[model samples]
Target: MRSLFKRCMSALACLLLALPAAAQPLPYHVDPDAREILPNLQPVPAIRFLTTADFPPFNFRDPGGELIGFNIDLARRICIEVNVACTIQAWPWDQAANALADNQGDALIAGLSMTPENGELYDFSSVYLALPGRFLTRAQAVEGFRAETLDGQKVSVRAGSAHEQFLIRYLPNIERMEFDDELEALEAVKSGSVAAFFGDAMRASFWLNDNLACCGFAGEPYFRPDLFGDGLSIAMPAGNDAVRHAIDWALVRLKQNGALDELYLRWFPVGFY
Candidate 1:
């Protein structure tokens, strides 16, 4: 797994400092177009971020067994913004959540998507990245493609993914062909067996980096928060509002200074937004 900051640290630093530091454009991925500043947000007294390193680009272990990834970078930066010593430890995903709950960890820094049920057990910081829905079609397809125009086209989606369920519920008019995996679905599109592949925007974009000989995104990203959950966030145990709020404050500081976008682009060079 490639560590976003480790791979692009110098480039990201240059990108952030290109302009007068005060007037840089805050990078917002899409829709809710502005980053919500948490005025009342505050940080915990100390910072110890618990995480799992299986999710690459976001969180993963390097070949040296060192913890390194976007989430790891984000966690360290947040601690620096809060002016505290920070320690990150990798645990099993389930244990990370438990560690936070048991007070063994101060925060959980995995790629956790916000959900209603999880909301009851934990509080989360504002989103750092959204896993949106996107369409993959032949590069030569018509311009100005839109959902309304997909009515008669054959689109493939993983049989039971959230994207598939979203297609069934929201864009029922389009002809959806279910496949067992996104790779197979994408292959179908490549073979001209299907007009497009509909799925997770991040995965699809990454897929295109290596296999886009015949395809590209067909439309603007679909960010149905209802279907995709609420994006990746810092999950802190419920009732730990101080820690949650503090992380939120740190996020705002990072975003305002362009550090957030730097990390974002480093990890997601082939971004949908």
Candidate 2:
């Protein structure tokens, strides 16, 4: 009887030992001393970042099918500076907000726009890049293009994007076709199925310049303070103060040291402005 009691206690002890390991949350919180180290001496967590691989000049897969772009490069650099092991996991842009909210990844570093609605869903790092909305259409479709020009035209925009909201608010005359991603919108325009598409100017320019025969920038960019917000920011789960502070500090330091400018030049040799 004593032997059986000893065996039961040993089993209970083993279970107790395993419980803490399973219940422990990911170590997203940084040490106070680590912050003092600034860009260095910070222990990098082994983390995966979710991003939309289709958004180019910012984040996308190269000809070799490996992820490469400005955001991807910047994320890698940030990981290096913070001394963290990181990987970029491609996900649909529309799904990124939910993915991070669900804790599927540590953060979303895609060229995520900072809007009030999004702010309610996730915390954001400091703005890294400012982008404006632009129209994309075939060159032949460009003449006399205006908000009025969209009347009765089929327009494509990625669902859940600010451009879609802009269209619904201002250009109700146009028939808006919602897509799961900007790539799908671009494909519709390329295949001549959609009259025009709206997206970030940099993304539109990259696609138009690269896929010259199919599409081109149609008109000057449209900007509204309320709809677009300030610019693009890295997204983390709401209340992730540690990650936010780390990223904000990293951005400020990089900009101050001109590293951010060098990165911009490396990607946008002609300049985005």
Candidate 3:
């Protein structure tokens, strides 16, 4: 009876110890050398990714109600390569940023650009694409255009965007009308509520070709080094080294395998950047 009691106590202690280890979150990293030799090494589990579904050509909800776009497709591919299930949640762009900050999602796969202000709040993956900004105006608005054509003209831009920051710093005298999304900004331009709308060249081209019957690029493409960073990248909340590493590795693999190039061609056949 004494021996059996001692054996039972020992088994309970071992089970208690193992329980804690099993309940703990998986470590993000493993020793590379050991992992290389151990084929059975497990990866960190998948976490949800949040994005705004309004940005077309990057992430948008299709008529079929599926989240479908370049970024969405790329993120799904990356998750597959990493052997994790990725859940995409659509929220407003600003709400998505807040959700990422609050740890509601593992990362933001929207067409997020790496800017100094944003970098202060989050970690960023290597750039996936480089696109220039363009100015769109009604064809009649360009009739008497000069170097300072946009001066004093009401311009619509997405609030808190790189274009907004650029205009604030460089074109301070211009009347600025900020919108929550590009579609809204385009609407403001189309309705004559604003004289012009400034955004990515690809997006502007998309709008002009698809939506705006009388609007087109008014001037040469603008590339400001200080305002727009090298290109757009995926964003993860600050100090998320594990998630960042996995995403970076997956992106590099996609680029190397010609998947990214193929995606660009398929989405933007006319070419961007």
Candidate 4:
């Protein structure tokens, strides 16, 4: 019975991925969603991944002191499919890139955006996740809201983030309050101090549903990949094609077999799509 239940769930997961195809366009800046994995390549014997637990549902730990979430589960699945050993350790969020750079880890798989500049420094797999931008406001204020309606209203955005740059380019007339981080900006909205908060749709979805329920989605999710770059991909030091290809191959297998969709549904029951 348990095996049958698992099979049914897997079948439904694949259906969910296909059902949303037309309604939701793929979030990518580049054409061709995935690269073809090279044939007959050997995966490295071992891998140590560096990631952070600060982001919930994506890479945070559980109450049982177990490291679990989308990235953690996907990372383990990738290693399993490729038949390689991999370890994920929760390090300080800021240290993931450097740890991979310094060889302290083999891959960095927290929610990382893929960009050409980073491409110069690291070989990135196809995006396993793409988080679009969302606007959140008090429920009463959410109806019929548009970017133009925000003119002169206090809007909160994370300083030095893509969302902040987006407002500068598109919503220039709004009053911008730059917060040091996402929680601060969202809190401003929760307190009614700011009219709205602009942030990653995934985080905003999780936050509004779980932590701060006073706010709701203000508008459609924005998927301007030119502004946000490609979705989050795993990163390895530049020129390491073997490990890179191995992980990418695993991603392709995961998607084709529906494990990726299962993880997505598990974490994002109220997903942006």
The parts of candidate 2 lying over 4 Å away from their true place are: 1-47, 133-224
Query: Please, what's the RMSD in Å of model 4?
Result: 8.5
Residue 113 of candidate 3: its Cα lDDT? 62
Model 2 residue 207 CA deviation (Å) reads 7.5
TM-score between candidate 4 and the true structure: 0.70
Which ranges of candidate 3 are over 4 A from the true structure?
Answer: 1-43, 134-199, 207-223
**Model 1, position 206: C-alpha lDDT score:** 58
> Candidate 1 lDDT, tens digit per residue, 101-134?
7888878888765777777888887787777788
114-133: candidate 2 lDDT, tens digit per residue: 76788788888767776668
Screening candidate 1 with a backbone cut-off below 3 angstroms (N, C-alpha, C), the clashing residue pairs are: 42-245, 42-246, 43-246
User: Per-residue alpha-carbon lDDT of model 4 for 1-273, expressed as tens digits?
Assistant: 112222233333333334432223233222346565544445488778888866655566555566766788888998888887888888877787888888888899876656667777888877777668989898888889887889999999999988999999999999999998677798899898999999888666655544434768787888778876667788899987788878888888788777887777665655664
Instruction: Give the Cα error of residue 269 in candidate 4, in Å.
Output: 3.6
TM agreement with the true structure for every prediction: 0.82, 0.55, 0.57, 0.70
The global C-alpha lDDT for each of the candidates, from Candidate 1 onward, is 0.74, 0.68, 0.68, 0.74
Better of 3 and 4 by TM-score: 4
The candidate, 2 or 4, that scores higher on TM-score is 4
